[model samples]
Target: MKKGLKTLLIIIAVILVITLPIISSYNNLVSLEQKVDQSASNIDTNLQRRSDLIPNLVNTVKGYAAHEEEIFTDIAEARSKLAGATNVSEQADADSELSNALSRLLVVVEKYPDLKANENFIALSDELAGTENRIAIARQDYNKIATEYNTKRRKFPTTIIASIFNFEEKPLYKADQGATEVPKVDFAD
Candidate 1:
């Protein structure tokens, strides 16, 4: 009886020793993934805030530059694309398009000094700027957490566990092409 009890105890200890690290690793991956998801949501929230601010800004500018109907149409289309974007890449592209349109709108504003000086336009611009900063910070946080999760999932023992659990790699948010370029606004038109 003593020998049998000792064997059972040894088996239990071995099972725990084998399972504990796997459990710990899985829990850690789950936590990191949740953080990444939350950070991504934060980006979406800030983007929505900016989107909400755009209509007011557009209206304010429209009151002054009603003749610039083409730029306003471009802004509307870009805003719609951004609203319909399902993922990071699509959102980035749509965001770049919207930024380009806004740049042209700014040039139009330059032509109308009164719009730039409008109190409503100034307030909306400030709000949009703040939201852009929030989006940037959120993207940075998401990338950092995603990098950590990806690294952890790719490591030796964790890699094996990750594969078994289907812990797919998280994608980093990248800016769209031409996003860094200053959109040229032609005054000659």
Candidate 2:
């Protein structure tokens, strides 16, 4: 009976030793996943701020350039794409599209001196530019966190734990096409 009890105790100890590290690693993956999710939320909030500013700018420009339907249409279409975006990757793509459309609209505005002089249009433009800056910063932050979390999930023993928990690798939020172009902000004078 003494030998049997000793054997049972040894088996239990071995199981605990084997399972503890796996459990701890799984917990770490969960924590990293939460961090990634929070960062994504932060990016979304800033993007929403930029989206909210578009309507006012569009309306202000429309008041002055009623005949510029193509520009307005482009802005409206881009806004719709952004609003319907389902994920971070989709949002990045839509964001690039919106930027391109806004650039085109701004080019049209160059011909309208009266629109340029409008106080409301200028205020809205400033707001949009500021929000874009915020969004860019927020996107960088999110990407950093996501990279860390993804690396953690993919590394060594953590990868085994992550696989057991079905933790898939997340895609990085990359800038869309033409994102390298310097933003035009000429509120001076």
Candidate 3:
């Protein structure tokens, strides 16, 4: 009986020694993935807030610059694309397009000093700016957490576990090409 008990105890210990690290790694990966998902949701929330504010901004600008039909159309189209975007890459591209369209609209506003000075426009602009800042911070947080998760998942024993569990890599958010360029505003127009 003593010898049989000893054998059973050894088997249990061996199983624990092998399984504990795998369990720990999987739990850690799950926690990090949840953080990444929450951060992505934060970005979407901020983007939605900005989208909600655009119509008010557009209407205020429209009141002053009725003839700027082309810019308004562009803004509307860009807004539609942004609203329909399904993933991070599509969101980035649509965001860049909306930003460029807004820049052109700003130039139009510049032509009408009164629009810039309007209280409604000023308030909406401030809200939009704050939301944009939130969006940037959210994107940064998402990338940081996602990078950490990816790194951990790709490491030694964890990599084996991650592969078995199908922990696919999360994509890092990248800015659209030419997003850094200062949109040229033709004052001549």
Candidate 4:
């Protein structure tokens, strides 16, 4: 009986020793996933901030360039798409669309000297430019966190734990295929 009890105790200890690392690894993966999520959220917040700024800018430009209906319509449509985007990749694409539309709108504004010199319009443009910078920084930070999470989750025993937890990879915020080309709103003429 004593020998049997000792064997049982040894078996329990071995099981715990083998399982503890797995449990710890699983917890670490969860933490990394949460970090990536938080980073993504931060980027979304900046995107929303920029989107919110668009209305005022659009309204100001509308007064100066009432005939530019197409640009306004495109901006509104892009904004709607951005608002309804369901995933990170969709949101990024919509964001780029909105940026292009807004760029076009700005180019149209350049046709009017008064609008270009308006203090309110200039302030809004500065704010929009600053928000764009913020979005870029947020995206960079999110990508870094996501890369770390993905790498950790795909390696060794952590991969098994990640699979068990269903922690899938995140989509990178990549530029569109034509991103290297000039934006459609070029007014170099």
Candidate 5:
């Protein structure tokens, strides 16, 4: 009877030895998933910061270029879309629209030397640019973390574990349309 009890104890120990690595992998995957989520949240925070800066920017521009009401309206609409977005994909789309609108607004600003020279507009533009940089960094970090988590979860034995645990794949942050296009600058013109 003592020998039988000893054999049972040994079997339990062997099972633990076999399962420990799998347990460790599961924990690591969870950690990576959380990191990805946190990074995505950081991106949203930065985007929100940029959105908050938009009104002042729009107002300052309005003060100078009051005739350019349509551009200001477009910016306001895009900013609202961004603020109302509930998910990452929606946020990405809205952000792209807002960025395009801002680019158009900048073009409008270029037409007015007085607006460009305004101290308030300059400060707001500087703040918006800095916020955009932060948003880019945050997006990159999120994509990196998501990629690592995805790769690890999809590899070999972890794939089985991920399937059993129902780990979902994350979507990547996509760049805006026309972002890859090279500018046509003709100094001769």
Candidate 6:
């Protein structure tokens, strides 16, 4: 009976020795996932800020150029796409569309010096630019965390734990087409 009890205690200890690492790995994955989520939320917040500013910008421009209906419609549709996005992939797609629409709107503005000079439009433009920077930074941070988490999830031992817990892979923000093209910043008058 004493021999049997000793064997049982050894078995229990062996189980714990193995189970502890699994628990620690699982916890690290969970923390990494949470970090990715928080970073995504940061991006969402900035995008929302940019979206919220669009109305003021659109209306201010409308006051100067009411006939530019198509641009306004395009901008509205892009904003809608962004609003309806459910995840990082969807948001990236919509974000690309919204950027295109905003670019077109800017081109339209170039036709009207008065609109370009409008203080409200200028302020809104600067604010939107800053928010875009913040979004880029947040997305970079998210991608880094996601890559680390994905690596850990796929690694041996942890892979088994991750699968059992259903810890799926997170998506990364892919750059839009033509995003790599350098803009020609000519200062020549």
In TM-score terms, which candidate is top? 3
| Candidate 1 TM-score, C-alpha based | 0.91
lDDT of 5 by residue, 1-189 (tens): 699999999999999998997898899889999999899899989998999999999888888889989999899999899989988899999999999899889888887899898898889999988999999999999999999999999998889889989988888898877889985644341
Better of 1 and 4 by TM-score: 4
- Candidate 3 per-residue C-alpha lDDT over 71-138 given as tens digits, one digit per residue, 9 for 90 to 100: 99998999899999998788888988998898888778788888888899899989988998998999
Question: Can you rank all candidates by lDDT, best first?
Answer: 6, 4, 5, 3, 1, 2
Instruction: For residue 110, give model 6's deviation from the true position in Å.
Output: 1.5
Instruction: List per-prediction Cα lDDT, in the order shown.
Output: 0.88, 0.84, 0.89, 0.90, 0.90, 0.91
Estimated TM-score for each candidate: 0.91, 0.86, 0.93, 0.92, 0.92, 0.91
Candidate 3, overall lDDT? 0.89
Judge candidate 2 against the unseen true structure and give its global Cα lDDT, from 0 to 1: 0.84
Could you tell me the lDDT of residue 128 within candidate 3?
89
Q: What is candidate 4's lDDT per residue for 98-117, written digit by digit as tens? A: 98898789789889999999
Q: Supply the TM-score for candidate 5.
A: 0.92
Candidate 4 positional error at 87, Å: 0.6
- Candidate 4 differs from the real structure by a C-alpha RMSD in angstroms, to one decimal, of 2.0
Top lDDT model: 6
lDDT string for model 2 (140-163, tens) is: 888888898889988998888888
lDDT of 1 at 33: 88
Q: Where's the lowest-lDDT run of ten residues in candidate 1?
A: 176-185
Task: Please list the residue runs of candidate 3 whose C-alpha ends up more than 4 Å from where it truly belongs after superposition.
Answer: 180-189
